[model samples]
Target: MALRPNPTLRQRRVGTELRRMREQAGLGGNQLARELGIHAAQVTQMETGKSGISVERLRTIAAACLCGNQPLIDALADMVSERGKGWWEKYRGTLSTDFLEIAELEANAHSISTWATTYVPGLQQTEDYAAAMFSRFTPSPPSHDLDARTSFRMQRKEAVRHGKTPYASFIHEAALRMQFGGPRVLADQLNHLVDDSLAGRISVRVVPFDLDTFPGGGENIMFIEGPVPELATLQMDTAMGSMYFDAQPSLTRHRDVFARLNSVALSEPESREFIRSIEYEMRGKYA
Candidate 1:
């Protein structure tokens, strides 16, 4: 069968995990090919996501690589079993690949934890708030592009809501207070946040400005937990673009960062009260 010219991020991730297993077993690509009775080039193709692997083939490779982690093995096999294109595929050519990747990651995530210092987490932003923020792009996007992005974001939010993924968001006070569209927009956005939190659909915690000795220096982090811990992905949003990290050490570091943030941030109930207070404050000011 012909190979895909550009595989989705999820497809590439399966290939990456296979490569890691091969390396951990101390077997080179040629050795792996020989063990599986395949050409070295074929092995490379599989590892680069240029080709697909069947569940049986994946099992054979995992066994040969001496990978004993049943959960990890099962996860890889499941990836191989996935069929058809996801909703994000429709925007393949229209949107940035990174944006589509984010949607795919969220769709497959077992749980999601985010840390936002400047802006409300994308999944939690209201339509008007998001539209206003997107309008600030340098050189500005064409109207259609802006509409597409905002529509895509709303779809992402719906996916998150219906997926029932456990979502924990650690937001700094500065972000909650930022009036991207104005006091009215911020008020509505905060009220929507309160409703989501009250309904037990999402967890929202706030890091107040009054706290001393805060770490992390205004970083935006989104940690996506896969079926297995080993398959977890960490995404850092920056001005340039989104950066993903999956190395054990990198995952460990971000986990620790989140833990520390959790420790200092307001508890869930307290966070709810805090948001309500802010919403009240905003309404009064705007009124």
Candidate 2:
């Protein structure tokens, strides 16, 4: 098969796992290709997600390599078995691949845990709030592009809405205080957050500002649990762009960070009350 120029993150991750397997088996790309009776370039293609691999092929490779991690093998086989594009596919050309990758990440997640400092997590933001935040982008996007971005964000909520996926969010008090779309919009958004929390739709934990220390240096971090522990990934937003890490070390570090963050965040009931208090404060001033 010809090389694929732009495989999605998930695809690339598949290749990553395959490469890991080869390395674990103590086989170089050329060596594995020889063992599998294929060209070294094909092995490279599979490892880079430039070419697709079937579940059978995956199992074959695993068997050839004497992989004993059946759980991980099964998990990866199941991933390649997935047949269709998710809702995010429709926005392929209109938005950056990062946006689509995030949606895909959430859609397939067994659970989501995130720390938000500058703004509400995208999965929890109201349409108006999202639009307001996006509107402030430098060299503003065209009005139509703005609408597309906002709609894409709102649609991304399906992954968490209706309790489809378990979501745990650690939001800073400062983010809750920002008036993204003016006080009225923010009040409504706060009300929505409170309602969502109380209704058992998702878990909200507030990280109060009084805390002496902050985690992740106030950067946004999203840790998505995959089908199996081996597949979990950590995503961070930086000045460069969205970056995803699935290496064991990165996942382990973020998992520890989130645990510490959770340790300081308010309990569920406390968080709801805290959110409601802000809602009331915003309402009292601007309602």
Candidate 3:
């Protein structure tokens, strides 16, 4: 079968697991391919998530690799059999693949933690706020493009709100206070935040500007916890795209960073109060 070229995270994940199993068994790609009577390039493609593997083929490879663990085999089989259009497919021609990949990661993440220093995190952004933020870029986006982006964002937010996943975010006070879409929009967004907080699907905290410092102080970051423990932590960078790190030492460092940020952020109740206070200030402008 021809390779899919651009595979979804689900597909890539399955491929990653297969590769890990092969490595664990001390078998090289060429050796595995030779054993399976397939070209080495095909093995490489499957391992890299550029192609899909069938259940029977996967089982054969698993057995040859000595991956007798039934649970692991079952998981691989399940991932291969699982078929559906990813949320990102809709925006394929409109947005970059990198953007779609980020959306997919957010959708599939078991838990997500983000620290926003400049703007409201996309998942938490209100439509008007998103429109205003996008409007500020140089050259200015066309009306249709801006609307499409906004629609895409709203759809993503719904996925998070309705899905079984959990989301937590630390917003810098500056971000919450930014007058995007003017005072009316800002107030509505803050009010929406207040309401969403009450929903229990999301946890919001404010990182005070006075807080001493941290490595991520100036950077916007999103850390997503994946379903599998080994795949758990992903750090997203706008410029660098998504990076997955499973090493204990690296995970420990990022976790510590989050803990420090959490410590400095206003408690959830305090955050709501802070937001309410800001809303009050904006009301005068809108009124």
Candidate 4:
């Protein structure tokens, strides 16, 4: 069978670690290829997630790259053997590359933390809210494309709902009150959030608008905690595309930001009450 056109997040993450190791080893693609006794193109394919590497070969490459830690080597070997399909795979070719990548990362995350100042996080959005947001995209997407986006988004929500792992989200009060799809959609979304929050699949905390001091006040970010040896963080800038970071310092900075934001957000019960207030206000108009 022909190889799949799209790569899963785990594969891409593995590829990223390999590329980083090669760079850190002061070896270029050609040099690494020489060390591995493989063609440079083959090395490039593996590093770009277009192809897989065998465990034995991966170990050999790690040794060549001076990655001697046994745990790190073992992790790389495991990554090489990962062949499970991620939920994002079904949406391949339908959504934009950036969006698809985000979905994959979200699916693979051991834990997720998001700071949203203008809109609810994708994983927490209800179907109607998602549709309204999609409808606002510039030039507007075709009906079919919009439907595909909605379906893809709903699938993403399902991953969080059913996964063994959990997700944590910090939403600015502005996002909760943004009214993306008018009162009706906003009401439903808020109610859905309340349900999800109470269910324990997601942790929803609201940052009151009056808070004068807050981390990530000016930026919206999604931080995903990847498995070890491939430890990484992916940041999405609304205007600027997505950027992937694996450097320890950078990941620490984001983690710190999330911690600070979490510290300032309302407690779980308080957040539910805050959301309930918004829903009640919306009901007055839409109910």
Question: After TM-score superposition, what is the CA distance of residue 273 in candidate 1 from its true location, in Å?
Answer: 2.1
lDDT of 4 by residue, 1-287 (tens): 23436766567767888888889899999999998888898887888787877898888888899976677678767767877666676666777777778877776677888888888988889999999998987889999999998888888888778887668889889899988989999999999989988998789899998888678536668888766624757576566566666677877877888889877889999999999999999989965
Relative to the unseen true structure, what is the C-alpha lDDT of residue 135 in candidate 3, on a scale of 0 to 100?
93
Native-structure RMSD, model 1: 1.4
Superposition TM-score, candidate 1 onto the true structure? 0.96
Please provide, for model 2 over 1-287, each residue's C-alpha lDDT reduced to its tens digit, 9 standing for 90 to 100. Answer: 66789988888999999999989989899888888899998999999999999999999999888899999999999988888888888899999988999988988899999899988888889999999988987888999899999999888885569547888889999999999988888999998888778878688899988888787766788999998999999988876779899999888888888889888889989998988898888888865
Candidate 4 TM-score, C-alpha based: 0.89
Per-residue lDDT for 11 in model 1?
81
Model 3 deviation from native, Cα RMSD in Å: 2.9
Which candidate number would show the highest lDDT if scored against the true structure? 1
Which regions of candidate 2 fall more than 4 Å away from where they truly are?
none
| Location of the lowest summed lDDT over 10 successive residues in candidate 4 | 1-10
Clashes in each model (backbone N, CA, C under 3 Å)?
0, 0, 0, 0
Candidate 3: tens digits of C-alpha lDDT, residues 193-247? 8888888889998876677664464666788776445565556555454455555
True lDDT of residue 4, candidate 2? 84
Give the C-alpha lDDT of model 2.
0.89
Error of 4 at 224 (Å): 1.3
Candidate lDDT (C-alpha), each = 0.91, 0.89, 0.81, 0.82
Steric clash pairs (candidate 3): none
- Compute each candidate's TM-score over C-alphas: 0.96, 0.96, 0.85, 0.89
- Candidate 3 TM-score to native: 0.85
